[model samples]
Structures are given as C-alpha cells and as structure tokens.
Target: MPDGAPADTVTQLRRDLAAAYRLIAHFGMDDGIYTHISARLPDGPGGEKRFLLNPYGLRFDEVTAANLVTVDETGAVVDDPYGAGVNAAGFTIHSAVHMARHDAVCVLHTHTVAGVAVSSIKEGLLPLNQWSAQFFNRIAFHDYEGIALNLEERERIVADLGEKQVMLLRNHGTLLLGRSVAEAVKLALNLERSCKAQVAALGMGQTPIVLPDDVAEHTAGQYQKMYDKMEGAGGKDPEWDAFLRMLETAAPGYKG
Candidate 1:
C-alpha cells in the first residue's frame, strides 16, 4: 500500500509511486534508471516496517504499478514477483532517512545534471533568487563518501540531514524527504529548478545579487507556511494531479 498504509493503500501507493516514477522521467530527472524513490510500506510482512522500491534494471519510464517490489529495512526483498530484486547501493540513502525519520513517508534522490553540478560546488546553493530563497536555512549538505553502500554511510546521511526537508549530497546529487509522495515530488521539482536557475545565472559571468538575510528568511518562512497548509490539508497537490493526467498521454500504463 502507498506509504504502507494497508489494503487499498497498497493499490493507491502502487499507482502513485508508479506515477511518481513517470513524472520524474517526464522532467528528465531520472538518470538511466539508476536513482530511486522509495516509500515506506506500513503493512509490511511480519508487521515489520517495509518499503516499496523499483526493481533493478528497469528504466523509470518503464516502471509500472505491478513491477514495484517490497523490501525490508536491510534492502532485502520481502516480496518480488519478477525476481528483479533490489538495489543495495541506492537503498542505502533511502533506508537511512526511513529508519531515522518516521515523519518522512517518501525519500526521493536524483542524479540530474544540474543537481550534481550544484552538489560539487563548495558554496552549495546560494540565496540568489526567489526559488533559491525558499531553501534558505532549510537544506543540509552531506559530504560524499564515495558510493553509498555501507550502513555507516546511511547513519552519517541521517545525521547530516537532521530535520531538513532537502539535502545536497556533496559531490554527488540531491536528496529530498517528505511526509507524502506529493510533498517529496514537489520539493524535488523546486530544488531542481533552483539548481538549474543557479547554473544558468552563473553562465552569465556575473554574480547575481543575493537576497538579504531578513528577506530570505521571511520568504522561506512564507513558503514553509504554504507547505504546512498543504500537509495539513491531506497533502493534496494540484500539480501532482495535473502530472498524472499528462502521464496518461505521455507515458500511459504506469497505473497498471
């Protein structure tokens, strides 16, 4: 079930998770099916916490509801109809947040060009524009320790992320945590756009004026309020709904 709720929850989760994959692919965020977006399965086998993950070897655009598999906390497959199994390295980051932050229902990671470019920069994301201002004091940075494959790295990531909603995997990519798939998806989109804008602005060979601390903090606070309102109101996102409709035309059959 989506977020591991129960019964129909699985069906809805399957559809929404699949839709998320298609949407990521639609936005050119997916990197040859390498990155992952995981959701906690509340009704996992043995009453233990489990998660829904995309089976390895499948492109994001090829992900369908029926192809998603269930995995335990250790990246072991709890259930697999296709026998495609799981991605140990990819799950390392997701499992860390899932285990440490119970409030995070969805963990989305991406290896987009802009995301990786920004991650490699030392200054990280500058509060240059309104989009960038939204992340002021709301993002974390974790030093990359090579490819994430060990449990210790997971613990470090969790520690660095703390309570922030977004994180930049230094010299790597980006990580987003959300209480719902819609929230996570929206955050990822905004972060990507922010990075993309930063990179474009830098190309102009002129340092963009940074927002003052007071203005940046106030703008970020306003955005946080809107997010709180969305989360409180059942996490409904009109953008997600519009994306699903677009998926039906651009990449149909994700719901299957």
Candidate 2:
C-alpha cells in the first residue's frame, strides 16, 4: 500500500481512483481541474459512509494515490494529508448517487467538448453506430439545473438517474456509474468516444443513418450480457487490466 494510507481495501481504492484520474487526463477526457471522478470507500469502523475524491485544485494528471482526499457523506474531509480541499460541486453530484445508489461504487462526471456538445442536442445520444448503440435505451438524462452546488438538488438528480448506469446532464455533460473504478473508467471512455462519433456524424451535414430500434436494443443487450458475465465471474475486467498496463508506461506514478 502507498504511504500514509491504511493497508487495506482503501489503499487499492485510492490507487484505482487515482489511476482513473490519470487515464481520464491521458485520454483527453479531463477538463483541466474541473469535473470529478469519485469512488465510494468502505464504511469506517464506526460505519460512517466515506468516499475518495480528487483534490479540488489539482489537475487530474497531478493526482496521486497518496494525495487523494477522503470525505464523509456530508462532504467534510476526513483524511487529507496534503490538505487539498474537495470540490463542493463534486460532493453535491457524487454524494447524491452514492447515497441513493448502493451499486454505484464509482461515479464519473466529465465535461469533455464532445460530451457537452451531445448533451446540448435535443435527441441526446443517437444510436448512430455500434459504439453509440451500446447505451441505447440504457442511458438516462437529467436536465441541467445550473451548477450542481446546492444540496437540495441531490434529490432531483437521483430521481432523474433512477437505476441507469449512464446519464447525460442535459446542457451540462455526462455522468456514469459503475460497480467499480475500472468499470467506471470503461464506461466513461466508451461514452466519450460515442459522443465524439455523434458530433462528427452530425457535423457532416448529410443525413446520418441511425440503427433500427430493434437492432440498437439487441446490440445493447449483447453488451450488457458480456458485462454481466464479467461481473458474475468476480469482476475481473480485461479492458481495465489493459488500461492499467498502459498506465504503467503512459502515466506512471498514479500509484504513488
């Protein structure tokens, strides 16, 4: 385990969450020091809910396992060796899902250009291709309600999210929920790519060929079945493993 952290599950959670930040930056999905990717930590000995959040002022590329902040459900920093404060907006959004959706171990929010562009569209994410079809009928939408800083907005956010794994904060950006940090990263990557494709296709000024409803739903089912198989087999995600290997070379020191 990294220094200054308990030698237990939290250690691994920190590394995985930090790796996610690094990977998001490496893939150009990060928006400077804005946006947030959070992972719920195991309850403390006293059973208080806690989460791992990137420090508010640090760029995703600068986040390391040892520097990530640990906060309670109320957004107060419980552990901050570096004294890096958590973002209020991050707490508002992440806490909403974490409190309501016990299955969402990791919640990733992004403000990528493609994601924002797609979020502004009326149709939301169109099933323009295989990448886009993966979320067909599976994604949710929450209308933008200014910046997510008010605690009262949490209820509506959860209501809009329902049980969906992916959501587009209309006029804002994208939100993804995963059973683990790895799963969250995979979802964010695919979602970003899907948005990019949609933006490009729509910009071509030609009528885009959208997949039939049946075909789109069938494709989504295939993707979900594969994911369910992986989860049932003990959550060993191959794509996440591959990304960790890439990180070993591409953006080392996230585990520091």
Candidate 3:
C-alpha cells in the first residue's frame, strides 16, 4: 500500500505535503476540502511520473501525507489508496497544469473570499504597489467556465497561462505555479495577498497608485530578475513554515 516508495522515502515528504494542507487552513483558504494544493514528485527510477495530493472529502485540517494520493501525469490514480482519497474532479484543474508544465513541480489553487473578489474585478489586478508590481503585467484571466470539468478546458487554461505564472479563474479562484514547492507556495500566498490588497484598495474608493504601462513592465522585469537569482534555491519561506507549525498547534490532529 506504500505506492512503491520505500517506506522511509515517503514519510518526510508526506509531512511536508500535509503541512501544505495545514498552511492552507491557517490562511483561511479551503472550501470544505474542495480546493487543492499538489506537488509533482520527481519520476522514480522506473520512469513513472508521480505526484502528491490531499485525498478527496477530507477537511484541510484532516489531511496527512500518509493519506496523500499518488497519481500519474494523466490524472490517473496509478498508486493505491493514499492520502484521504483522490478526487477525480481535481483533474479538471491540477491535471492540466501538471501535464502542461514539466517544470511545474508544485501547483496551488484556492477559492478564498478575497481571491474570488479580485477574480470578479473588471479592472483586474492594478499596480497599486511594489507588492503587486510583479503581477502588474503578468497575471492572466480566464473567463468563467462553469465547473471546469471538461478535459478540453485544459487547453484553454494552458493557453491562458502562456508565460505567466499567476492566473485568476474568473468567478472561481486563483492559481500559482512554480518549479519548486517553496516557489509555488510563495507564489500562491503572494497572489492571494495581492488580491486582498486590491479588494481593500477598492473598498476605500481610494485612487490606487496604478503605475504607467511602461513603468509596470519595468518593475515586473526587475522583480523577475530578483527571483531568478534565488530560483530553485528559493528556500523554505519562514512565514509559510511558521504558518504550518501554527496549524499544527491550532489543529493538532492535521498531520496525522
């Protein structure tokens, strides 16, 4: 039942994967175990592609790596029972990205309150400040497609994603992709914060400091360069790590 991973090989990673679920809970993101966060495990020596996911129907706090489902790139449940259980619906979103982006090691999606708010904003993400500047010229929006269960939607999603790393599924949620777990984790959290900022700015009816088009492009390039330096080496972000620990304390049984 260990999915072919040596017994000890999967333990630490299971904890890390579980921590991701717990962190999602800490951030007030999770729709009764509906949304998801997933990571592509490097292919084993056998040449099969494997990934980790929170099993279906389990509340975010109830997730544990040991219970994480291991699946193939095609969204097939190649591995036996793991995680809480696999949701076939997850293939709607995560499978597309996993199959489309070979470098997309970790993909995080959310349906948080602010995230959905920004997704519906007609003006979209404005360059209100440096925190959002990275997204100024980089966010892509996909029009609402009721429930995204269509396999064909994968092509449309990938088309919308293009070279951008952050996306908003209109009337749905936000998505972030990165080649490493740390990078992907930070990207999603940052995207959520950006959306939260946009919602707050709009609520006050304040004139947001939208950078000129040229300025937005320049700033995005600068931020991209800064991240490029730290790239895969993007270490464990202390904030996310601490958040995971906090979840452990608040929901002590989550890492079970």
Candidate 4:
C-alpha cells in the first residue's frame, strides 16, 4: 500500500467530508475561516494515527475533496499533497472528542451567530420547539475556557461531553458528533435551527411555550428512533442526497 490512505477509502471519505463543509457554508453555519469538521482515518501502513480536516486558512466553501488535509492525532500535517498546514490550535476540541468517543467518527464544530447567541444565555438550549425538544435532556455544556488551544483542555472537554451527541460551549458555539459525516451534518442543521428558533422566541418578550416534561421526553425518543431507522438497512439519510445535489449544482467539481 502507499504511504497515505487507500485510494478508494480516501476518495469516499474526501467526498463525504468535503460535502459536509460545503453544506455548512451553504446553510450559513460557517464562521469564515474558523471552526472545523474532522473525520477519523484508519491507522496508516506504519500504524500512524491520522484524521482528515480542511486545510488551514481556506473558507469552508472553497474546500474540495482534494484539498482536505490529513493530520496526525496531534494535529500535525502528515500527508496532505497540497502541503497545507493544520489548525492545531482549534483542533484541540476535535481531537478530544475523536479520541474519547469511539463512536464519533465525524466531529463538527461551528460558530454560527444563532448558536453563539443561545450559548450566551444562562438557560442554554430550551425545549421551546420540536427541533429543541429532540435535544431535551440529552445535550451537554462545557464552560468556555478562553480559546481551545491547550492540550490539557482536551481532558476537560471529553469529561464534559461524555456520551452526549451535541454540546453547547458556554459563551461560544456548538459541537456535534456522529458515527458518520452525514449524521453529524444532520445534527448540526437541527441544532442550528433549534438555536435560531430560541433566539427568535426570546426576542418576542412574551413567554415562550415550553413542552411538558413527558411530551418532550417522548418527542426526543421518537427523534432518536427515527435516526436509528435512517441508519438501518435499506434506509437512507434525508439530508445527504439533498446536500450532494446542492453541491453538484452550485459548487461543481466539489468531489474532485
């Protein structure tokens, strides 16, 4: 085998991860050159651990299958053909979840306006809407400790996010983890929608209607069951195909 990933696996992972970046940009979830989404790479021929991430300094919309960089678990660029650098400073959070959560094959972090706004609120995300209800009693929160640059922060982050699908960084943004890129993207979209709806509701001055505990728990369970079904045999993800088509039309050659 070559020094890098097997061509077929690399090809599929690249397309899947690049599509996620484009979808994030398309839906206005990107924060310019900030934020990151990473996919775990199988151990290399030499038993080196690595992951795929966007090249540092590129806008999410500019990412393509070929431009994504491969980096070691420590955030060091390993075999990126373009010689692009890694975002070690920002990757602290990503590496933490990827290493701690074995099921987190794909990790996405975003700094969208709505997410940040909701994070600053004392109550965090509320079950004020169907979208928010899905996260009821299931989300985690981590206090903002300045920027996530230090490696020591990794332990704290992993401890805070234990077994949760989504995490809200206090006074910061949101983080989502999934077994695949498609699942993470879908969760990201829902979380952003939840935050946006909460922001809108809070501005109205009138008290927002919160679902009863039983109803919220029931709705959350239903949402989880739906996700499980989508991951089953003969089932399909609802957002992956739609976003792929969007990229095909607007960002042609994204898979290249």
Candidate 5:
C-alpha cells in the first residue's frame, strides 16, 4: 500500500475510483480516453500528496482497481504497475483542485455534448428544472485558455473555482468535486442531466421558464439540507449503495 497509507484504505479507494470510471462510462459521460476522475490518496511519507488517476489512453470501462496509477502533486507517476502514465492535461486540471481544496477528495471532469453546450451558453446553467435548481448560485465558471497542459493555468483554475463544488469550464466541459467517490459520481450524474435538460428546453425556440431567485435559492437550500442529513447519519448514502449494486450486475470486475 504506498508507504504511509493503510492497506485497507488504499484498497477501498482504488475500488471506489475504479467504480467511478466505469459508472461514468456506463452513463455515457466519458469522452474516449480524455477527461478524468481523480481521488486524493492519504498523504504519503513526508506529507507528500498523492492521487489515484486512470492511466492515459485507458477507456473508463477498462479502469480496474489494480490498474489505476498513483501520482504525486507534480503529476509524476509514483506507482504505475501497468506503466501507463497519466494524461498531462488531466493532471493539470485535477491537481489544481486537489491542491487548492482540501474538502474535494474526489474530482470529476467530463466532456459530454450537453455539458459543453450549456457551458457555451451565455446564461450557463439556469434553474429551468428541479435538477438544475440544486446548482443555482453554487456553480463556478472558468474561462477556457486552450488545452490545460500549461502548469501556469492551475492558479487561475483554482481562483475561478474558489470554494464552489461545481464548475463549468466555459466552452470546454463540466467539473465537480465531492468529499468521496460516491458523492462525486452523484454530482456528475445530476449535473449532466441538468445540462441535458437545459439544452432540450432551449432548443424548443421558446423563452424557457426560469425559477425566481428566491425560489431557486430555497430549492438549493433544501438539497443542501438533505445532503447534511446524510452526512449527519454517518455518511451511509443509500443512493451510492444502490449505484454500487447496479454496477455489480451491469459491469462487474472493476474491483479486480
């Protein structure tokens, strides 16, 4: 298990992260071998920060627990049994959040057509539906500055993200963070659906109905309350458990 981290902890983290990759693929959110889902590992020896990321060129469905690569904050491969290094752009985007936000244990980024469509829109993610209302006033936006290979852009990414858990990489895609793999998956799924709905609504060529600011804020508060209750109840997220069960039947062997 990578020096300072407990064996059981790392094992579970690998399985969880692998499952996230498979789920993203199953939901059609994956963009071939691009984009990424990363989980911050427990600090290694000497307080070195590390993360588990899918190897570059591996489709999400192929990300087995045993195959995921471990990398340091500098994006260097620390433990890559398959000898598959990570994508440089993925590292730049994920590492920025991992370094800046201690609360973001799992960082998920996607390039769905609907997500990019919404990102391209001037209004961004409007509260056009109940699902979209959950993100009202909570999502951040980062202007695109070409591909994210340049290390210097990390500072701007962090600054734009600020303290928000969800972000729209304008004209690029969607990004979100969660305290765990399950939470990240949940947020990504919801955000994708919200974007899809917005695109469909706007395509009708009619003025879409948007919730009032107060109502939208209230709905967002309600969602937060539900999340807080789940956290208070020992973090036993039943929805995440159900998703795991679905994954077991639909796409097994991710835990391998």
Candidate 6:
C-alpha cells in the first residue's frame, strides 16, 4: 500500500475540504444542517474504502477541518479522532452513489431555497438560458421518501440516478456527483443557478421555451467535454486545497 503523501499534502486536503464547506455556506447552499457534501479519499495500497464527510449535527457554517469524519464504506468511523462523526443520511446517500458510479468521487447535496422551489415545481428545471442548458438533458428526478436515514433506500436511490450525475430530489433538494471535488462543486453551483433561474422565470409569468433534445444533448456534451479538457490539461487544485487555510483563519478547531 502506498503510504500516501507527506503530512503537508494531507493537511492541505483537509483545508481544501473545509474551504469548500465555507464556500457552500457562503452561497447559501447549506440548509441549516440538513444536507451534506462528501469526498472519497484516494484508494491506494493499504487504504480501506474511506471518505471525508460532515460531522453529524454540525451546521455547515460551523464545520472545521478537524471535525470532518473519516469513515469506511459502511459508515464506520475508522479514523476520526476529533470527536466529529459522519452524518448517517450523508452515508446513506453518498455511499450508494459511490458504489454505483465509480467515477463519482464527490457528492454534493443541497436544500437551498431555489433548488427546492424548482424541485417542487412540476417541470423541474427547464432550458431557459445557457446556464440552465448545462443540465439540459443530463438531469434526473427522485421523489422524496422522508429523511434519508433508512439503509434500504440505497438500492432505489441508485436506480433513480441510473447514469446521471445530477439529480433533483422532489420536495427535497438537488444532488451533484462528479469524479472530483471541483467537478462536483461546479456541477452543484450550476445546478443551483439552474434552479434559481427556473423559479425566477416561472415567477415572471412567462412560458419557458424548453430547448430541443438535440440542443440539450449538445450542451450536455459540451459541458462533459469541458470537464474532460480541464482534467486533461493538468492544472493544480491548491485553490481548493487553500480553502482550509482560510478556514483556519476563520474557524479553526475542526482540526482538533
């Protein structure tokens, strides 16, 4: 098994994850303490299937680097020493995505006002603009089944998501799964923007001209390619990694 990287590299990852928490909170993506965002740790030699997740009952705004729970696939706290625990719903939701979609190393779930508003709408998000067009033909819808605490829900959840990276949980919120932290965050950002656009457009009392299937497929293709390009270009991810640095300045002790 690879001994992983140096302590400095590991520390930077914690900060990046923390920064993501703050960024999501800044964007109002966090619904009190209801939703969750998680990242799968790199699976190297000697590594158990592990992940970093928000501590159970911690508000997003209150999250700290030290507080993030490191757990195995079964939601067991294998390495959390700072007393923070993983959110069970986060496990129930993210574990299914990770298992079914090997490419989804990150999963972001949000219950923002606009997202829920659009999800509750009969037509979910429509192709009202370029931003909304990003999800054009790439969105899935899952009906709400109360809080996601039941382990039995995993099968149905993955089935609902099938081959889609974006899902609109009716009466719940939206979820974005991706191959990396940045990709997942970008998807969530766009998904929120799409939901906001949908709610606002509907509120304007104007009929939305949904895009043609061909156009939607093309747009989704463009987006998928853009991510591929970013991956292929070999750029550094310190920006996200540096987020933890900011959190240390703002809210430390999550590392404790």
lDDT of 3 at 39: 82
**Candidate 6 residue pairs in clash (backbone atoms < 3 Å):** 1-45, 15-244, 66-254, 66-255, 67-254
Pick out the ten consecutive residues of candidate 2 with the lowest summed lDDT.
1-10
Candidate 4 local lDDT, 1-256, one digit each (tens): 1246577976887899999999999999998899999998887778876788988889999898898998888888887765668778888999888878877879999999999999898899999989999999998999999989889989999999989989999999999998788889999999999999999998999999999989999999999998878867667986678788888898887788
Model 3 TM-score, 2 decimals: 0.85
All candidates: CA RMSD (Å): 1.7, 2.8, 3.5, 2.3, 1.8, 3.2
Candidate 4 stretches with Cα past 4 Å from truth are 1-6
Q: Estimate, for each residue in 1-256, the C-alpha lDDT of model 6 and write its tens digit.
A: 0146576756655655666677788677888877778777766467567778888777887776677878777788877755756666567888888767877767888889998889897888888777888888688888989988888888898999999889999998888987666778778888888888778777898777788878877887897887777655475555445654665676665454
lDDT assessment of candidate 3: 0.77
**Would you estimate the TM-scores of all the predictions?**
0.95, 0.95, 0.85, 0.95, 0.96, 0.85
- Please list the C-alpha lDDT of all candidates, in the order they appear: 0.88, 0.90, 0.77, 0.88, 0.91, 0.77
> Least lDDT summed over 10 consecutive residues: which range in candidate 5?
226-235
75-193 per-residue lDDT for model 3 (tens digits): 67866464345777776688888878877867888898988998887877788877788787688888998997788898999999987778989988999887656566777777788
Q: What residue pairs clash in candidate 4, if any at all? A: none
Model 6: weakest 10-residue lDDT segment is 1-10
lDDT per residue (tens digit) for residues 38-145 in model 2: 888878777788888888899999999999998999889999867869886678989999999999889999999999999998999999999999999998999988
In order, how many clashes per candidate?
6, 0, 5, 0, 0, 5
Ranking of all candidate structures by their TM-score, best first: 5, 2, 1, 4, 6, 3
Cα lDDT tens digits, model 5, 1-256, are 2347688888988999999999999999999999999999988778899999999889999999999999999889999977879886678999999999988879999999999999998889999989999999999999999999899999999999999999999999999998788888988999999999999998999999999999999999998887767656376789988988998998898999
Best by lDDT: 5
Which is the winner by lDDT between candidate 3 and candidate 4? 4
Compared to the true structure, candidate 1 yields what TM-score?
Answer: 0.95
What local lDDT does model 5 show for residue 146?
98
Candidate 1 regions exceeding 4 Å error are: 1-4, 233-235
